[model samples]
Every structure is written in C-alpha cells, then in structure tokens.
Target: MMMKKKSKLFVNCEEAVKICDKSQYNEAGLWDKIRLKLHLILCGGCKKYSSSNSKLTSLCSKAKLNALTHQQKEAMKKVIESESAK
Candidate 1:
C-alpha cells in the first residue's frame, strides 16, 4: 500500500504535459489533475509548457481570426447570387 501510494503521487514532465493538455480539454480525471499540479510544482519545463499552452489557448479563443481572402469572398458572393437567381 505504501509503495503504491508513493508510485502514484508524482508524474514526470511528459506525463505532466499530456495531463495539462488533457486538463485544458477537460478530459483529465480529478486524480490526474492533482498529480499534474504536483508535478508542475517540481518541474520547471512542464510548468513553462503548461503556461505557454494556456496562453495559446486563450489567445486562440479570443482572437477574431479572419482567414477568407477578399477575392474568395467576392467569388463566393457571386456564386451565391447566381445560384439564387436560378
């Protein structure tokens, strides 16, 4: 029982990153989040990765990214008008 407890308590940097990503998606279990939190306290690389991931997530979330080109939009509009006229 003691060894089991010890073995499950800490995760390595790799596990922490995977867990952190899973956590961002709400896919990680409670125990996984706890273990990830513990690992982040000790592992600087994982912590940095987690922070960067969070920033990327939030930036993507709030960013109004417009990918359509003006030419594409005009072409699409012309297609729609032609279709509607028929």
Candidate 2:
C-alpha cells in the first residue's frame, strides 16, 4: 500500500521554523500560524527553539546594517576555507 502524503498546511516544528523565517507570525497564513501556535502550546522544546531562533534572526538583521570590518571578514573567510578543506 502506498502511504498518503501530508499537506503543507499542517506543519511541524522544523517547518514552523522555516515559515517563521519567511513571514512574520501575525502575517503568516491561518494554517501556518495555527500549526505553529499549536506546536508551541504542546512542546516546550519547540517553543524555546523558536524563541532563540527569532532572537538570533533579529540580531543578524541589526548586524547586517553595520557589517563586520575588513579584518573580521578576512578572519571569517579564513575560517570558512579551513572548514571547507577539512
């Protein structure tokens, strides 16, 4: 027997994270918002996870306007290259 495919309208914690990243909570469509709210109500781990991700996203947005210095960029590039080589 073939398994049924689930609809995107019903999302889980990971999907909620992706949706939240793309749209504001209030602006997200009804299904997405409802799914997220339900998950948050039942799952403490997911709630904390979502909160931290939101905070991190806000921090990154603020940092982008006043970006890293050349020295910091170079350091980041070096780190990236080293990680890629490994």
**lDDT for each residue of candidate 2 in 1-86, tens digit (9 for 90 to 100):** 99989875466767867666655434677677778777787778778877887898788778886779999999999999999999
lDDT of each: 0.89, 0.76
Stretches of model 2 off by over 4 angstroms after superposition = 5-9, 24-27, 60-64, 68-86
lDDT of 1 at 5: 52
lDDT of 1 by residue, 1-86 (tens): 36545468888787788899999888999999999989988888888999999998899889966789999999999999999999
Please state every model's RMSD to the true fold in angstroms.
7.7, 6.7
Least well predicted 10-residue stretch by lDDT in candidate 1: 1-10
Candidate 1 global CA lDDT score: 0.89
Number of the top-ranking candidate, with TM-score as the measure: 1
Can you give the TM-score per candidate against the true fold? 0.66, 0.50
